[model samples]
Target: MALREQLDADMKTALREKDSLKLSTVRMIKSAMKYKETEPGAAGPLDDAGILQVITSEIKKRRDSVTEYEKAGRSDLADKEKAEIAVLQHYLPEQLTAAELEKAVADAIAEAGAEGPRDMGKVMKVLTPRIQGRADGKVAADLVKQKLAT
Candidate 1:
């Protein structure tokens, strides 16, 4: 099934199961998707890839919140954000393993013929699409930087 359909089904299941956390997170995702759909130049309803982008963005936001909450010594709020992250993560593609990400970064570097750090953009241009929704951009960029530094 498509992601939209899956979300609908899961939403219904959450409602039935009285899973407040999941229901709220799913609603949040749908809200974000609706907002994206209405954005200027939005092509229309999102495809799976587009929906994945939205889901990924939501997860990132939660992660940032978790960090901020932790810094404020609000363990309760941080735990909430972490739970939301867990809910949001279910919809994303399985994350790339460290070795897999390293290999992919190396492959991108070679494919782009990136000779040094100056060519980071070139490597990332080749890499981003391949890793999108499966790997964190910061992690991938850091790996690229590490590989390029040597």
Candidate 2:
């Protein structure tokens, strides 16, 4: 089934099971997705990749919140953000391990012929799609810089 259908089904399940956190998270995702579908230029219902894009963006926002909450000494809010992250993460592709990410970055650098930090753009262009939603952009960029500078 398409992600939209899956979300609908999950929403029902969350309701039936009284899973408030999951229900809210799913509802938030569905809301974003519905907005996307009805947006002026949308062609049709979202494909899996499109749905994943929305989920990934949501997760990124939650991660930022987690960081901010932690910095502000609000463990309660940070914990909630972490819980939301856990729920949202189920929709993402498996994350790359440190070794896997390092290897992939090296390959991207080589493929893009990136010889130095100045070539970061070229390497990122080649790398971003390959690792999308699988690796954090900041981590990937840091790894790329480390690899390129050596």
Candidate 3:
């Protein structure tokens, strides 16, 4: 099934099971999808790739909020954000490990013939699509910079 369909099904399941966290996360994703559809110039319903991007962005936002909450000594709010992040993460593709990400960066560098940090853009242009939804852009960029600097 498509990601959106699966999400809808899961939303029903969450309601049946009384899973508030899952239900809330699914509803949030649906809201984002709906917002995208209603946006000016949105041509059609989002594809799986677009849905994945939206989900990943939501997860990232939660993580960042969690960090900020923790830094402000608000453990209660941080814990809530962490829980939501964990629930949202279930819909994302399996994340690449640091080692796996490093290898991907190396391969991308070689594929793009990236020579120095100056070629970071070229490497990123080649790598983004391959790693999308599987890895965080900041993490990938850091790895790419590390590889190119070596």
Candidate 4:
């Protein structure tokens, strides 16, 4: 089923099961998807990749907020953001392990013939699609840097 439909079904199930966290998280995702649908030039309904991108962006935003809140000594706010992140992550694909990410970066570097950091753009071009929805861009970039430096 389409992600949006699946999310809607899950939302209903969550309501019936009294899963407050999942319900809220799913509703937030649904709202973001709806907003994207209404945006200009969005084309038809978003594909799985597009939905994953939206979910990833939402998680990234929450993570960033958690960092900022913690830096400001607002532990309560940070905790709330972290909780939301945990809930949202339940829908994401299993993340790549460090070792697996290293392998992926090495492969991408080899495929792109990236000899040095100057070829980061080329490496990123080859790596982004491979890692998309499976890992964070920052994490992937770090792995790519580590692979290229050696």
For each candidate in turn, the TM-score is 0.98, 0.91, 0.94, 0.91
* TM-score, predicted candidate 1 vs. hidden true structure: 0.98
Off by over 4 Å in 1: none
Summarize candidate 3's per-residue lDDT along 23-48 as a digit string, tens digits.
Answer: 98899999998898889999789999
Model 1's lDDT to the true fold? Answer: 0.95
Q: Candidate 4: lDDT of 135? A: 92
What do the candidate models score in CA lDDT, each in turn?
0.95, 0.91, 0.90, 0.88
Cα lDDT for residue 54, candidate 2: 88
| Rank list by TM-score | 1, 3, 4, 2
Rank ordering of all candidates by lDDT, starting from the highest = 1, 2, 3, 4
Expressed as tens digits, the lDDT of each residue in 1-150 for candidate 2 is: 776788889899999999999999999998898899999989888888889888988988999999999999999999999999999998888999999999899899989998899999999999999998898889999999988888
Candidate 1, residue 133: Cα displacement in angstroms equals 1.0
Which TM-score value belongs to model 2? 0.91
Whole-model lDDT, model 4: 0.88
Candidate that would win on lDDT: 1
Q: Is candidate 2 or candidate 4 better by lDDT?
A: 2
- How many clashes (backbone atoms < 3 Å, residues ≥3 apart in a chain or on different chains) does model 1 have? 0
lDDT tens digits by residue: candidate 4, 1-150? 776778888999999999887888888898898788889988868888888998999999999999899999999999988988988777778999988888888888889999998999999999999888899999899878877787
Greater lDDT among 1 and 4 belongs to: 1
